[model samples]
Structure formats: structure tokens, C-alpha cells
Target: MQETILNIYLVIDKGSVTSFRAKAYEMEGEDSAKIGFLKERATEDFASAFVFDSPKNKKGEYMPYKKFSKLEKQGLQYQLFEEIFEKFRVPQNPLICVTPVVDGEVFGKK
Candidate 1:
């Protein structure tokens, strides 16, 4: 059995800054149905782009964004996206930050 654990972060900057985390899991393809349901929910919730943390290789190097498509490919991103979409009711063009780095320390930081 294999499982992927991700530390998902969502950073939003208005006047101040905010960050959130959501955990997502898929058990060796056995739970794919749940993943699909989440994907559908996300699509119905938003019609804009989703900003994700750059995928990293085994060496911890960032990979290009084009290399990945579906959010489910990165379980954290998928779960975070769905959770935010359902809870926040963010606008269609909302930015879903998926990086471990916090705001104020990065571009969106104060």
C-alpha cells in the first residue's frame, strides 16, 4: 500500500494575509470515485484558473506548470481547491495558492 501526503496551503491577501490547509488522500486508485466527485464539484464551483505550487521532482526541484494538468494529480491541491470552492465561495478568478511558503515572506505577503 502506498499513500501520498501533501502539506497544502492556500494563501489569500486582502488587507492582511490568510493561509489555510486541507488534506486529501487517494488509496492506490481504490478511492478514485471520490476524487472524481471532488473534481466535478470544483469545476461547477469555478471557471477560472487555479494556481498551484510547482510540482517537484524526486530531487525537490520545481517542475514546470505545464507538466501537470488535473489538480487531483497533486492530492493536496485537489482537496484544497474543493474545500475552498465549497466553503469560501471565492470568485471565479480566485487564486488558489498551493505553496508551503507563507505570505509576507513571498510575493503575496505583506
Candidate 2:
């Protein structure tokens, strides 16, 4: 048997910058129905952008902007995500990403 780790990446726009992380975590979970709901709730605390984990088949592959018709290569969404990360203390520029890297685990049925 193997256990899978699931994580969601979200951008927090804290007005003060110091309290955003706390606010972001407070709203993330499996129970979340609407991504916008979390963002709206946290608007007072900070603005947030949540990136749900891509399907396994899509792993390691490039993800493009949802609004853009072009494929990942031409998509600027990834770069935009990085731009948001840089706003925090993260050192990486648009080229580097701060999203959580997750590994999956499956168990055989007995």
C-alpha cells in the first residue's frame, strides 16, 4: 500500500505581506467547493490564486493559461504565476516556481 500526498498551490495577496500565509492556509482544503469562494473570503486578509494539482498524465508537461487557446509553450500563465510568487519573499523570478511538488502513492486492494 502507498499513500499519496495532495497539495494545492495558491497565491495570496496580503495587504501587509506578513500575514498572508496564515490566511491562505486557513482556506485551503478538500472541502473547498469554489476556488473563488476562498479568494473572496480571504480578500480582507489577502488576494489569492489557487492552482489545483494537474492530473497525473499531465505531470511534467507544460500547462497553459485557461483563457489562452495556445498550448503550454506559448502560454504566459506559468510566467504569471511565478510573477506572483516573486511578490512574496521568494527569491526566484518568473523563471522559478514555488508551487508544491507532490508525489502520489497507490495501494493494492486485498
Q: Which candidate should be chosen as best, given TM-score against the real structure? A: 1
In candidate 2, stretches whose alpha carbon ends up further than 4 angstroms from where it belongs are 1-26, 34-76, 89-110
Model 1 C-alpha lDDT per residue in residues 1-110, reported as the tens digit of each score: 53432223444443222334433333344435444444444322222333444334797754333333344475434543555455445445433333432333332222
**Top model number, lDDT:** 1
Residue-level lDDT of model 2, residues 1-110, one tens digit each, is 11111122322222111111212222223433333443334433322333333321245533332322243347543543343353333334212212321221111111
TM-score of candidate 2 versus the correct structure, residues matched by position: 0.23
Which residue runs of candidate 1 sit more than 4 Å off their true CA positions?
A: 5-9, 15-17, 30-110
lDDT of 2: 0.29
Estimated TM-score per prediction?
A: 0.24, 0.23
